[model samples]
Target: MDKTPSSPTAVEVLTNLVADDLKAVNLAIVERMQSPVALIPQLAGHLIAAGGKRLRPMLTLASAQLLNYQGDKHIGLAACVEFIHTATLLHDDVVDESDLRRGQDSANAIWGNKPSVLVGDFLFSRSFELMVQADSLKVMEILSHASSVIAQGEVLQLITANDADTTQEAYLEVIQAKTAQLFAAACHVGGLVAGSTPEEEEALQAYGNNLGIAFQLIDDALDYSAKQAELGKAVGDDFRDGKMTLPVILAVARGDDEEKAFWKRTQEDQEFRDGDLEHALSLLNKHNTLDDTVSRARDYGNQAISVLDIFPDSPAKEALKGIVTFCIERAY
Candidate 1:
C-alpha cells in the first residue's frame, strides 16, 4: 500500500517536440497506410486511429534534440520508428489472437488475420522507404538490424510460450531482443543523426536498452495490478495466451510445491479450467512476485537515468529523464 508519486524529469520537456513529431508521424502513417485497394486501407486505418503513446518516435526525436540535431531527417526517422512499432503490434495481435488493444478491437480481430498481417507487411515496407530517404548509411544499418532482431525475438517468444521450464535467463533474452533492441537502436540512431561521438552514441544506446527493459517490466506488472478497464484488456491476457513473462517466471521459481502445481495447471495444461486464472493470481500475490518485478523495473529505470549523466543538463535531457519516470509511474 505504498502509493508514492513519481516525479517528471525525462520526456516531459519534449512535449512540444513530441507533439510536432507526432503530427508528422500520424500523417506519415496515414499516407503510408493508403492503398488503391480498399480492404487494406480500411484495415490499416482502424489500427492507426486507435491512439497509442507513440513512445518510440518520441525517443528518436528527443535523443536527436538532446545532441543538438538541426535537420529534418529526424522527423522522417521518428516517423519510421513509429511505423516499425505499429507493424510489430499488428503482427503481435495476430499471433496472440487478441481481441482488444488500446480499448479498441485489435486489427486482427477487426479485419481478420490475413489482412492484418498484410497491412503489417505494408507498414514494414513503408518504414524501410522512410529509412532509405534518411540517406544516412548508419541510420539504415541501425534500423535494419533492429527490425531483424525484433522478428527473431518474436519467434523466440513464440517458442517459450506455455513452456513452464523457461528460465529467467531465457525470458530476459526474449525481452532484450523483442523490446529493448529497438529502443536501443532508436536512441542510438538519434545520436547518429546528430553526429555524436562514439562514446555519446553508446551512452544513448545504454540508456535506451535499460529504459526498454524497465518499460517492459512495468507493462508485465500492470497486467496483474491494473483494472481491465484501465489496461484496455483483461488482467490475465498473457496467462490466457499461455505467454510466460517475467512475473510468471519469477513466481514459478519462488513458489512452493503447491503454487508450482497451480501454475502448471493454469499455464501449462492443455486446457485451463474454471478458477485457474484466479488461483494463479493468488500465487503471484502471496509470493510477492509482482512487487519484486516492480522493484526490478525501478532498478532498470535508475540505470537508464544514470546513462543520462553523460549529457549536460538541458531541456532535452530533462525530457529524457521524465520519460523514465513516466514509464514507472503510469497507471495504464
Candidate 2:
C-alpha cells in the first residue's frame, strides 16, 4: 500500500528495475527531438521536460526485459513509444484548449496552437524514423497501427464529448482505442524485439491493454474525486470540458430526473455557474459512481495481473504486477 509520494510505488519499482534502459530511452528521445528550426524542439521540450511518469515507454522497456531481451533495439523502440505519446499530448492540449499539463503551462498554452500541432507532428515523424531503425515490419506495423488507433480514439472521444447520452460501451471503446491500443502495442513490440513466442506476445499485449484500461478508468474517477484537488491536480477538467468519462456515464445512468437535467445542462449544453462542479461532484457521490468506477478499474487491473501468470515468476513479472497495483491505487 505504498500510496504516498514518500514511498516508491509500483511504477517506481519497475522504473528502478529498468533504470538503465530508461536512461537510454530518455537520451534517444532528447536526441531525436532536436531540430535546426529551434521552435520545434523548444515547444516539444517544454512538454517533455514537464516530467510525466514515462509509463508507456517504461512498459516497452519492461516487456523486453521480461522476455530476457538483450539487444539495444528496445531502446529506440521505447523512445519511439514516448514520441507517439508526447505527440498525442500536444495535440490533445490544443484540442482541449488546456492551459496546464503536468501542473505547468501546456505546450499549446505557451507556444500557441500552431506550433504545438506542428511539433506534435514532428514528434510523430520522429517516432516513425525510430520504427524504421528497428527494421522489423512486425514492429513497424504494431506501432504504426497503434498510432492510427490512437488518432481514431481521439476522434471518437470528440464525437462523444458533451453528450450525456453516451453509453458506457462507447466510452470503453474510446479509451481502448485512444489509450489502451498504444499500451498493448508498446508491450507487444517489446516481446517482438525479443523474438518471443506468439503466446507470450499475446500475453504481454493483453496485460498492457487491461492495465491501460484500468489506468484510464482510475483517471476518469480521479477527475471527480476530491483527492485529486488535494494533490494539486485539477479536479474538474473533464467536467468543465464536458468529457463523458466513466464516472459521469455511470452517474447519468443511475441519476434521477432532476440529476439528469443537471447533467444535460452542464454537459450537453456546456452551461456552468458557480458551484456547478460542486453539484456535479455531489451527484457523482450520490450515485456512488466514482467508487464504482474505481471498482471497475480494479476488475481490469486484476485481469492485467492474471495475464502475467502465464509468465514464470521473475522480477519483471512482479514489477509488471506492481504497475497494475499502481494504476488502480493512484485514485487514493
Candidate 3:
C-alpha cells in the first residue's frame, strides 16, 4: 500500500536516450504537421506545437536501441506514434468535455469541437501516411491494430460511464485497450525494426504492456491523491465525469448498503449535486480504496520490471527497469 515517491532511475535512463533522439522526432513532427489543408495546419500545429513529454516516441526509440537497432526508420515511426497519441488526446478532450490537458487548454476547448475533431482526423491520416512511407508492413499492422484497440476501449468506457455496476476487471480491460495497447505496439515495433530475435521482440512487447498497465494504474491512483492544481485539473475529475475508475470500483465493491446507494445515485439518479463528490470521497477513504489502488499499481510496477529480466544487463535494460519504478513514483 506504499504510495511514497520511488526513485526515478528508469525513466531518467529512458529520458536521456530519448532526449538524444528528440531532434529527429521533433523535426518529423514539425514537418508532418505542416498541411496545405489550411485549418488543419493551424489546429494541428497548435496541438503538436504545444509540446508534450513525447513519451510514446521515447518508448519506440528506447525499444529500438534496447535491441541494438541501427536503422533510421525508427525516427519516423517514433514520430508517428506520437502523432497518433496526440490525435487521441484531441478526441478524448471532446469526449470528456475537458478544458485542460498537460496544464494547457485542450484543443477542443480552444477551438470548436468540429474543428478539433477534424484536426484529430487529420493527424490520424498523417500518422498512417508516415507509417506507410516507412514501408514496414509489420509496423503498419502494429499501429493499425493499436488504433482499433484504443477506439474500442474508448467505446467501452462510454458504455460503462456512470454505471455503478462497472467491475474492476472490466475497468482494467478498458485501460489495457485504451492505453497499454499503444505502449505495447510502440515497443514491439521497435524490436521488429531492429530485426531482433523473436524472443527478444516478445520480451519487449511484454515489458511495454506491463509498463503501460503500471503507468495507467498509477495515473488512476494519482487522480485521487494528487492536488488539483498540481494535477492540472479539478480533483475527482473521474467522479465529476461519472467515470468509475479503480478507486471507485474498489470502494463501491466493498461498500455497505449506504455507500453503495451513494454511488448508485450518482450513476442512475442524474440529479446528483456537488456534495455527492465529497460523500463519495469520504466513502472511498472510509473503505481504504486509495491504498488498495496504490498497492495494485505497485504490483504492476514490479511485474513490469520482471519482464525485463530476459534482456541482458545494459543501460537500456537498467533504464527500462527504472521506468517501471518512475511510473509508480511520479508525483504528477
Residue 316 error for model 3, in Å?
1.4
Question: Candidate 1's residue-wise lDDT over 1-332, tens digit each?
Answer: 99887853444456665677668767877887788988887877777678776788889888998988878788888878887888999999999899998999898877799988988898899899999998988899999999999999999999999888899888889999989998998898888888889999999999999999998988877787756558687898888887889889988999888877877876778478888878778888887888888889889999999989989988788888888888887534
Tens digits of per-residue lDDT for model 2, 1-332? 77655877787799999999999999999899999999998888888998788999999999999989999999999999999999999999999998888878888888899999999999999999999999999999999999999999999999999999999999999999989999999999998999889999999999999999999999888888777766456889999999999999999999989999999999999989999999898888888998999999999999999988888898999999998998888898
Candidate 2 deviant stretches above 4 angstroms: 1-7, 230-232
Q: What is residue 75's positional error in candidate 3, in angstroms?
A: 0.6
Scanning candidate 2 in windows of ten residues, the lowest lDDT window is 224-233
lDDT of 3 at 302: 84
Sequence-dependent TM-score of model 1: 0.94
Rank by lDDT, descending? 2, 1, 3
What TM-score would each prediction reach against the true structure?
0.94, 0.97, 0.94
lDDT of 3: 0.83
Estimate the lDDT of model 2. 0.92
Provide the overall lDDT of each model, using Cα atoms, as 2-decimal numbers: 0.85, 0.92, 0.83
